[model samples]
Target chain A: MQENRSIPVMDVLIAVLLIAAGVASAMSARHLGKSVLEPIGPGAFPLAGSFLLIALSLLVIWRAVRVGTTKSNVDEFKPRPGMAVLALALTCAYFLVMQLEWLSFRWATVGYVTLLTAALFDWQPRKLPAAIVSGLIMGLGLTYAFTQVLYVDLPS
Target chain B: MEFLLPAIANVFTPMPFLMMLLGTTIGIVVGAIPGLSGGMVIALTLPLTFFMESTHALILMVSMYVGSTSGGLISATLMRMPGTPAALMTILDGFPMAKRGQPGRALGFGIMASFAGGMVSWLFLALLSPPLAEIAVRFGPYEIFSMTLVALMLISAVSAGSMIKGLLSGFLGILVSMVGVDPSSGALRLTFGVPDLETGFRLLPVILGMLVMSQVIGDIVNINQPIERVQTSFRSMFMSMNDLRRQWTNILRSSLIGTWIGILPGIGGTTAAIASYTTARNFSKTPEKFGTGTEDGIVAAETANNAAVNGALVPLITLGIPGSVIDVLLLGALIIHNLTPGPLLFQDSPEVAYGIIAGALVANVFMFIFMILGTPIIARLMYVSRAYLIPPIIVFCVIGAFAQGNRLFDVWIMLAFGVLGFLMMKAKIPTGPFVIGYILAPIAETQLRSGLMVYDSSFLPLLTRPVSAAFLVIAVLTLFWPFLMKRRKAPTAPAHLEDE
Candidate 1:
């Protein structure tokens, strides 16, 4: 049987994103104009950097196409995309709650910690209590330490 | 020399001394836990230093650097998992030795080797950095620009993964650094009309996001993996005089090797450990005994890694150039404290410079004592559940971001960079070069622009100036050296170790 090999989808995606960023940077640099005192301008470095990035990204695309991806290129740990996405979403919601000033730092953090900890623990029945307790301690403890001891002005 | 006494006095004072003790203890315990890194902890701790005296902050961070480099031995020996990348080599012999019923002996050898390495490198850090700074002080804009160029090139060339990918990551970082208003002109660029982007991304948010948040995300994914630890007693944790006598040469040689690698910009303790381990095996009379529980392997690896810690500090203190990832964080710390790093740091902030040197020595001694007495307790920390650890770390990251400027906008920047960092990790693009590029871009651009003005818009001075020319040539060679070695079919260190 012929061995299966495919293009590295991730590398290609990264290269495409880089190319777009490079193009945007070049456009921005063009509008920034040159410096009077020096031959180089505020835009010179970024312009040059953008060109190099585009070229290198092209090279990445070519390499991925020619060499193809192997099984070894994959990470050893099995990626749980579901868990990762959930974690990220929960984090974002927590941030939104804080951003809107819906709750104080302490309570928002307590909710975030409890939910994140429980989610990370796979929401098992036995571990929910432990997760909640941990959330309470971390939420209260960090708030006190940062505000009282460290004097950091967290959102009240 | 005049600053030596004051520096000693600064570190020996009650506050700084106590901070060093606390920093070293925390560093060791955190380092002993698998999946946690010294860089992550230090980044999380950066905001807490906002209210500290700069000297005290430096002492605390430097002590943590020393302790974390030595702490990985505990997990590497007992659980066969390197708590930090620096201990990757230690797992080879350390685990087998433990399995063979000599766990304490293995740890004893590792601790002694680490102490020896620390002492040897401390001498170089004290004696060598001063003169190196003296030389660096005389460098012109062209030379400084070339040096930064070489550092960037060296990191991309040596980082794991394709050279193109590393270069791309670095260039992306440079672009990210360009997002705020142009320093020379008052015009805003790359902000895309967002008012929050006016200041660009602050270093604290970017670093906290990249180093801490990304790792926490990965940890949560791997939270369910079981750990099987090898239990051992502390009875045999002391090395005999005979054993020290027999291993002295290996210890010295590996220490020197590690220190040399550490001075080279962009390489870290992991590379030092790998190189020393390979060299030790090559030089041993009974080389076959290496992988199956030999003291030589443990000694060389532990010694080189710990030695590299101080070795890395040399360049940071003298040239304002970071030698490794952790050194970049230290550079950030120095910058955050309103103290500029570089040769002038010696002239302007001599106490802080010498305080770092003194703090390293004191921290090493503390690391030796702590590891000797607290190994069993520290090893137990490796078993802590990630479910509890990851959430607190995220909280710290959030607070660290917000505390930078007391803005919710900074927290969002932290999350955005966290996602970018996580994607970069998934894509196998090394983060080290990205950070180096981010930190060095302003320096490179400023120096190069200054050089151009001095030379009347001619780039010829870059090649005509001797020091600048030499730096550019070395940069070219470093960029192509891997290809040359590959063509010659020479043995190389494992690719995974290069990422650290």
Candidate 2:
């Protein structure tokens, strides 16, 4: 079976995003103070960087297109979108749920770890208990270790 | 010489010695874990040192630095996973050796070389840093600006990827650094009206997000794929004297290379390992054996990386210029202790400088002993499931971000950067330049402005001043060297595939 070697659409999207960011940054830099005596204003460095980023973004797009069109150029790996989405959702959920103050630090961490592990491993009967136990130990153990030993205050 | 005895006495004390031992142990464990890096550990551990003495804090951080740099070899050898960026080269031969049923031998070579490298570079650090400081103190703003620019260019040039992309990543990091209010003018340049923007992005969150959190996310996305972990016998964990004797020259050469690369501003141990590995390959009688489980490859990589760790400290201690990402954390540790890094440090607080130097020597000894004895134990970490390992790393990231300023806002920022880092990796953009760029941007800006003020805003002095001129010339040459090589190699290189 032939391997999938399509160009990453994400590259083009990132390039577009970076270009838009560059334009915004450059425009904002112009609004900052720039005197003849001190031409290297605080904005000057960022403005230069924005332009470079724009150029580089275009280069990346060009490279992506050129590579995508080639028949024999096999890009061996592709990003797994299903896994990517799942991970991002879990990450966002972790932060968002923490902010809502619905659960204490240990409980929230336990829930986050347990749910994420289960989701990643398909919630197998054998793996589920192990995941829950591991979550409990890490969540409670780390909370105690950090607060008491390291003196770091975790959000309640 | 005068400070040496005092420093030794200080480090030999129970608290300092215990802290070094604890830090080394923690660093090795952290660095052996696939997604956790030494810098991440140090950044997280920084807040915990708030109540500790300056000597204890420095000792802990220095020991961690040595142990973490050495710890990376274990995972790289056993699992083909580089625990830290510096260990990337180790995976070239380390895994191959493990696959050939010589995991212990490869690790033995790596650990021994790490010890040699660390000790050799510590000597250089002790002998050279003070004199280097004396000369560096005389540098004008223009020279410093040019030097930093050279460092940026060198890093971008040597970074893995197209040079332009590396440059972009670096500059973008500088753009990120610019988000806070300007330090000199106190004027907001790019905060976009957010109150958090006033303080700019903290290094801890930015670094954790980029280096640690991103890796966790990546590991999560690939958790279903199982990785084989190689085990080694205790007997094979130590090299024979004959084996050590044979590689002495290679070890010395690599140690030198690693130390030199480490001292260069903004560079890190990874580059040192690469340089040493390549140089060792070029000079080897059995060059073909390098990628085929040869001890030479592991020695070169391990030795150079550890040496570079110590070498990086030379600039950080003597000149306030950070030689690597980890040193940036050390710079923060110094500042937190009310000790400023630079030449004045030697005069204003000689004890701190001596303490660091002495700590490095003792830490290296500890790293050597721990790595040799604990090889079998740390190897088990390689078998831990990604599901079990990665989530805790994320938790650490959150705690690390929050601990920096005791703010929840930093946690969100870390999450955002985590996404950004993941995207950049997917796009093949190197993260090293970006992180280095962000860290150096403020220094670059301040130096540039200071230089401009001295030269009455004429940019000519940046090029005409002898030292600054030399540095700029080197930067330009370094930037173009890759292009020149690519052009020369273009005829033999296959088309289309090269661009990808």
Candidate 3:
């Protein structure tokens, strides 16, 4: 069976969108400085990268035409939604917890890591408790190790 | 003689010796795990080294690097599942040999070949790095720019079928690179209403998205496919001395191939191992034995890949340039300790520099010993289901991101990159070079800008300067060389396809 042609087209479209976004952002940046600040300014490396991106995007578009329908079903594939959500939730909790000084980054880490780990290992429900316990042990261990032993500063 | 004396003092110190073993043990375990690589092991350890004594710290790090590369062969031989990417080629014959009841002989060939390749590469590094460092000292912005151009061209080499799609992915990454605040102008590029995207994509999340999350997505979708476990024993892991004797030539040839490939930056162990295997098969008297359980196949692949580890270090230690993303992370780790990696590293701190070289030697030795003893331990871990493993890994990723910087921004970036990375992988885009490009961009910019600053607002000196011009030439040649090779191989590929 043959694969769909839209995959490469979509890839090209995504590249174009990225290029447009990059160029538009650069234009907005020009307004902030009026003229680019000299010698490592607010706009220098990014503007250069933007122009390069535009050129590269155009190249991507051109190549998409030549690569038309060989046999790869790019759209037939789906991004792993389940694991990604689990990972995303963990991140959101880590960040949201960072804002509360009373919660303390150290203390919040224990709660978040423990809960996320328990949810992830649904294999052995009995092992879930062990996972939670290990998470707590590791979190506190790291807090002491990085903050006290290594003298690295952590969020209070 | 001058180098020999200081190397002795720094290398044999009791703490350094102990650390070398400790690092090697950790590195072997990490590398032997299916999901981890020597590069990642080095990266995480890099930050911690800042607080350590220079010699002791270096001994540990270099040892781990060597050990991890060697350790990958364990899973590759036993399960046909490679613990690391470079070991991918090893499974072709290593697993077949195991299935044929010759796992012990297959292992013996793999180890001896690894030792020889690593030692040979170490010799090359010891003799060659100083002279190469001298040459690197003459390089300027143009040279660095050209070097990056060559490194970027490596993406073409990695792309199996089509170079254009690979390049497009790379360029797409470069475009993504544009979205952050401009280094030269501080202009924000792509953050729309969401303030979070403004700092541009932090690499870890993107990498995680591509590597960890994308993989999970596929696994979850395909959860209905049942995977069977193949159980083997520790008793079968021993080799006869005669088996080692017979495979010596393959081991030596592959070791040489591995060491030379390792010397070149951008080209990695996977390429070297594959190249050596191809050469070994081509040169063999009995080619039919290769896939059906040949020791020569295992020897060729394992040796080259292990040696490639040492070879990648050449540029990092001598040029203050990294060969890969993990190397860049290593560079970051060094900076955190106020240590700059490059040619000057040898002159400024001979002990730390030589300790790395000596430690690599020790690491390989220890890797050999531990791999023999530790194979059973690692093989057992494979029995632990991914379902049991996934949750802890997810948590670690979170802690790793937030711990590096207390910013939740980093955690978000890590998740985003993880998704992007996964999709990119599925689409057949090579993520290795993109990560290389993202890390090298700042270096390329700073050097070019500084060089321009010296020339009174003219970009002409970049061409007119002899040293710079040479690098530009090399860069241009690098970009075009693949096209030239493909043109030459055109007729051969068709005939080859027919034979296949």
Candidate 4:
């Protein structure tokens, strides 16, 4: 499936990151000692894997560039901008708020789910109430199930 | 065999039985929904199983697996959509049959065929897994390491999208697994001085984030899209004697196909179903009627996919290699309970092995019963709003991640991987390799290192030993096959580079 090519700029970026990661892994492995007697150190596998990764990442970049230079890229998927941003923001904020102890885990989840659902549905007037109710059920039901039945402690 | 009685007794006991019932019910509901999958459900529910006995957990997961395969028929027949990927072919004939006013009859055929498939495949699973484990027991570290490499290469080659992306994902998974203290040297290799990083990422949260949370986020992004609902009533919910008599051969054939495919590593039920459906059509004297609301098509599709469910368990139980993404979670569940899989599992925890095999049989029976009785209720759930469903799953994802180490760091790791998974999906990269890579990397590394130690760091043994050499040769071929195929197809379409 790699013959027809659209230049994926994002993929190029990922390849660069992968290259950087490989370098970083190699640097990290250098700190761990490896000798002839102990050929397999803690860092041995990581070093080998990272070098393999670096080589592969270069191959990916070469292929991506080759495809982009040859012809126009395929029609790419365009996710709804508003929906994408809102979902991402809410997810990050949910993690941050819970981590910072701004609110109890249960409350933060309830608020996040309720708002996220409404936003995702674009606040259709007739569907708004049901969406809110659904969020509430999900939030509370999960809290109870996890804490009571599963015995998982939610951050308080 | 000595453990068989205890295994049966353990599974039939009250708590495990109840969990199976609950798991089956939940599986049906999740499977009936278009976006949700049995894998995601198991991943999300894994933490809850963390405290349970390994046998009970196996029973629960196995029942859910069976129920989900059966549950797909509800949506496949009612709507044109397959509830699960395995049901994709079912829509060809199932939906058409439902539209032709024989909804109940079509549903009956699917249900009955699924049962027959499950029974036939369960026979293979029960009989084959032990002997396979026995054979696997003889494998040395070199053989094991080479075999693991072969599994990784094969999975990367067969994944849905670009082979390179799949390989990259798998290697990336290996990198991720190497983040903490090295198991061999007792030295911190990649923790970056963070105490949490000392242990690296736990498998549960990593899996939950990628499979469940990523899916939830993706679903939420497209939440505005509406489903096409079908209104239908049940009638004649039983396969006639003549229909059963005529389709017996098809059922048996499809089941055997599924079982054999399931034994092969990395491939899943969808392939089995498609293969069975195609074979059945070719063999049918009335080929013209195959896809035109024919019972033969539904039977072939449903039977094979369900049979594959049990077939997939063979390698998982014996070799510790997951055949599909869902089975990876099953492996994760086993690890969570401190029950290591592989040939030693059969020798050490014979009861767990026997219990799982027995539980699958019981679960299949329960799945058939539940699908018949719970059809009406499950049909309603198919229309449940993504807004409602997606949010709860996210909540569960968080709880699942947090429950793993009772740490916030793991939760963040989950969110990070979720985003990574989402982007990978968007890029047309298959997440299958990533999970398999993540799960198998440690195994491969450990085994390779041990093998090297055994051979005094001579790589020659890997290529000189017959079994190991064969595996290494296959791995090389598996990795190159995609590129070879792509090269052959290159002249046809220069635009197909994105097919990865």
Question: Considering every candidate listed, which one attains the maximal TM-score?
Answer: 1
- Point out where model 1 deviates above 4 Å: A1-4, A72-78, B484-500
Highest lDDT, which number?
1
Error of 4 at B44 (Å): 0.5
For model 4, the chain A TM-score is 0.83
Clashing residue pairs, backbone N/CA/C < 3 A, model 4: A2-B497, A3-B497, A4-B494, A4-B495, A4-B496, A4-B497, A6-A73, B161-B500, B162-B500
lDDT of 4 by residue, B1-500 (tens): 66766777777789989988888888888888998888888887788887788888888998889888888888989977778889988888888888888888888999999999999999998888888899888889989898888777756645765677777877788888898877766678777677889888899788987787777767766665556556677778778899989999999999999888776666678878877887888788987786678999999999999999999898889888777788877987888888877777898899888888988898899888888877888888898777667666777788888887889888888988988888777666677788888888888888887887888887888988998999888788867766775686455322311221
Candidate 3 chain B weakest ten by summed lDDT: B491-500
Q: Candidate 4: where is the Cα deviation over 4 Å? A: A1-6, A35-38, A68-79, A125-132, A135-141, B464-467, B473-500
lDDT digits (tens) for residues A1-156 of candidate 4: 134546877678877887998888888887888744346767778888788889888887888888663343443444465786777788789888988889878778878888877776677787778766766776687778777887778755
| Candidate 1 lDDT over residue span B1-500, tens digit each | 67776787777789999989998998999888988888988888889999998889988998888888888998999988888899999998899999898899999999999999999999999999999988988989999888878777756544665777788888888888888987766668788788999998899899888878878777766765667678687778988999999999999999999999888776679879988998898789998888788999999999999999999999899988788888888888998999978887888888889999999989999999999999988877778888888888888899999998899889888988888887777778777777888888888888888898889988999999999999899778767765764665345544433442
* Residue pairs with clashing backbones, model 1: none
Could you report the DockQ of all the candidates, in the order they appear? 0.63, 0.49, 0.32, 0.46
Best by DockQ: 1
**Residue-level lDDT for B278 in candidate 4:** 77
- TM-score for each prediction? 0.95, 0.89, 0.85, 0.91
List the candidate numbers ranked by lDDT, top first. 1, 4, 2, 3
Report the lDDT of model 3 for residue A13: 63
Instruction: List the pairs of residues colliding in candidate 2.
Output: none
Model 3 residue runs over 4 Å out of place are: A1-17, A28-45, A58-80, A100-107, A154-156, B53-58, B158-162, B168-228, B235-241, B481-500
